[model samples]
Target: MSPEPLRSIHVVAGVISDARGRILLARRTEGRDLAGRWEFPGGKREAGETEAEALIRELQEELGITAEIGEPIINVPQQYPDKRLRLDVRRVLSWKGNPRGHEGQALAWVAPEKLPRYVMPPADRPVVAALLHPDRYLVTPSPADVDDETWLGALQRALESGVRRLQLRMPGVDAERRRRLARAAVEASQRAGVEVLINSDIGLARELGAGVHLRAAQLPELSVRPLPDAQPVAASCHTGEELRRAEDLGCDFAALGSVRETASHPGGSVLGWEGFARLREAVSLPIYAIGGLQPDHILEARQHGAQGIAAIRGLWAD
Candidate 1:
């Protein structure tokens, strides 16, 4: 006989912003799991309750406010040792009355930018990313075929088109040329206020004062994070084990896919949305669905527990 499947504990959380743009957080009372940790004020979704209804009830019970729930933000699926957890977060457009912790827990309103400073539960971390990070993480096409000027010009166009996060990946390019292009890309990205990552080259990433995006093979080579916490580090993962390792190494984000077939890898196995969700359930990292995805798929990606879409051709401005 087959083994029993794991059951997921569906949890709902609300992002309630104040007039000054600060968001609310509540401390978990002692004697509870993850006690003393600060988290978005919410609770489990009881049977027969919609996500909005659950959030509304949780807010009233925990924060003493009647919330007006808004659209979905990001649904995170994470696996803890004891149980599988799904954290569904939504924006609270408005609420009635002042918010006071009704359960003897402490409450604080935090600025969106300062959210990372507060220690939160593993499942709650991705909610912070969904609130603050961009919905698209652009991975550039290899620069082997294009001239430096032409490639850089396209990159400039991508930045102008609202690409806030990017990775410079140039497979098969010579070491000298790769460094030169990375230097140029880093300069351009800094000017545009975009976060740029160098693919699989820790030395270059450090030299440029940029982030690093590790290839899957590089995960086993280093036990510690290659750069400082101030510099974002990302990874490419195909399996749950790989994703777990990436999380263990403190990768800020990850790209997982071939969610659909693409011209670049015609015969590559596709994870589709379901497969992506399955892998996403194993970790708490913000993930971008790669391969055959465009900016238009952001909503669908979010629905399947993705931070956003990561693409090369789809994002590279023609």
Candidate 2:
């Protein structure tokens, strides 16, 4: 009889960084598993140790730095041909002390744009993709203002105006109506060479073969993974914790909002440039400054390390 094949179990880890958009990578020590390979600075979670606690401990032990672990950014499960491994990757942004290699291994702070230059584990690919395109927008046609014919025309106009990604968000419409609109939007976007995501209507998005975008409330325990056909799934994020969770869910991009004041979410506090910069340092994803954004704010957002700026009103303005 043939011998039973080996199996692998899931393990949690973190990608540690600082405020300057630099990631900490570790060189595996000589004589250790996967020696000479470079990887994010983290270790396996011990029993009874929370993921945050595990990350804090790993950073201290490996890099001699005291770290304050933030929310998780990306959780990727990968299988190597030689050894099957499921990696639950997190992103840690805050910490103290200049990092030094405590275990006699090499360490470096790499800029996000320079990540591709380094050799990384196969499991880190999705994490890399998230880093490349961090900001996402959810474009919803106003049902009250536009009829079906007008809506399609508006969508076409939006597409021609460089709205590559969109979400068909018609909340009160009936199922059949939503399906019809979603399919139409998908077809129109395809013709215009844009991408369309259906908001919360997974079945319709699947039927129409469109991407999906999750609302902030629906993020904590997402069941349906973004379908393979969609290629990119995005979400709306209001807090650093939520931003981290969205990244963990393998989101292609995310929108962080209320950067300035807006009517949509009245009285919501604006996280000015300082706050945006702080959050930008916490994760490797491409973040967009949402809410009361205008054309002039785009340059400022990019200066703060954001991928770009996203807005419903600003983009639609004449």
Candidate 3:
């Protein structure tokens, strides 16, 4: 019998950090593959071990720290010339014992902004982008009283004011209306060099030559991949599991939130800074803090290890 082909496997990673907002990275040991490169600490998943459990074990064995794993952040599927690996990364918020290089390698505490300065594994570039600009803006449509012209004007104004990314979320609009609006938004965003993601309208987004943003409700049923031509596909993830699914499905980014309470979803529980930080420790995907974000809070979001702050109100604030 012929030998079986090697199958791709999944592995979990830990983007472990402390309360001071420094990420823990390990230098690969000499003589190992990709030696001298810095990477988020983690290893392959052992049979019957959950992703979280694998991360905890990796941290304890490799760094001598007891990791209190939080929610997952991102799963990166990377194929190198030598090997293929799926990196399931999570955020680690709390842990016991100061991390030491138990594997006889070096460790460092790096701020997100300083990540670019270090030499890291090639698979970590997207992770770096996510860390730098974590938050994503989910732009809900204005009230019915707002006309198409007014909505376009609002979007235009927001784009001009430096809202680099947005999701056009007019769910109540009929299909025809949605297509027209998507076209208009795409035009405006192209003119201003901004990116627009149409909420849950893959076909319409394709027709309009725009990106797609998947809502959490639609995540489980996403059978078709977002069109590759769109460049970036994003998702709204309320929990670690959802974020993992989004990343596993090849989404370029995800919006994780209700970091703060807001009028948009009044009943949604606020995951304050502490909660947001906890989630941050779990994943390596770029997470944009959604729900109740304001412009002034951008720095605070960054401090918590988010890519950036994403907001409906704050991005539009005058």
Against the true structure, what is every candidate's RMSD?
1.5, 12.7, 11.0
lDDT to native, each model: 0.92, 0.69, 0.75
Count of clashes, each model:
0, 2, 17
Query: Which wins on lDDT, candidate 1 or candidate 2?
Result: 1
lDDT of 3 by residue, 170-273 (tens): 85677776677778888988888777888887787787788889889888887656779445788888887887788777787778788888997788788887
Runs in model 1 lying further than 4 Å from the true structure: 1-4
lDDT of 2 by residue, 1-318 (tens): 995664665456567666787877878888976688777787777779887787788788888888776655555444444554545566666678878888898988888788767776655554565565423443664665567887777667777777766777787777777678778889988787677778876666777777887888888868555667345677888788888788778776777776888887788798987677666544555666787876677656655555556776666523
| lDDT value, candidate 2, whole model | 0.69
Model 3, clash count? 17
TM-score of each: 0.96, 0.58, 0.62
Model 3 misplacement above 4 A: 1-127, 130-140
Winner of 2 and 3 under lDDT? 3
lDDT assessment of candidate 1: 0.92
Query: What is the descending lDDT order?
Result: 1, 3, 2
* Candidate 1 C-alpha lDDT tens digits along 112-134: 99999999998888788888998
Most lDDT-accurate candidate: 1
The runs of at least 3 residues in candidate 2 whose Cα sits more than 4 Å from the true structure, single-residue gaps closed, are 1-138
Indicate the residue-level lDDT of 317 in model 2.
Answer: 23
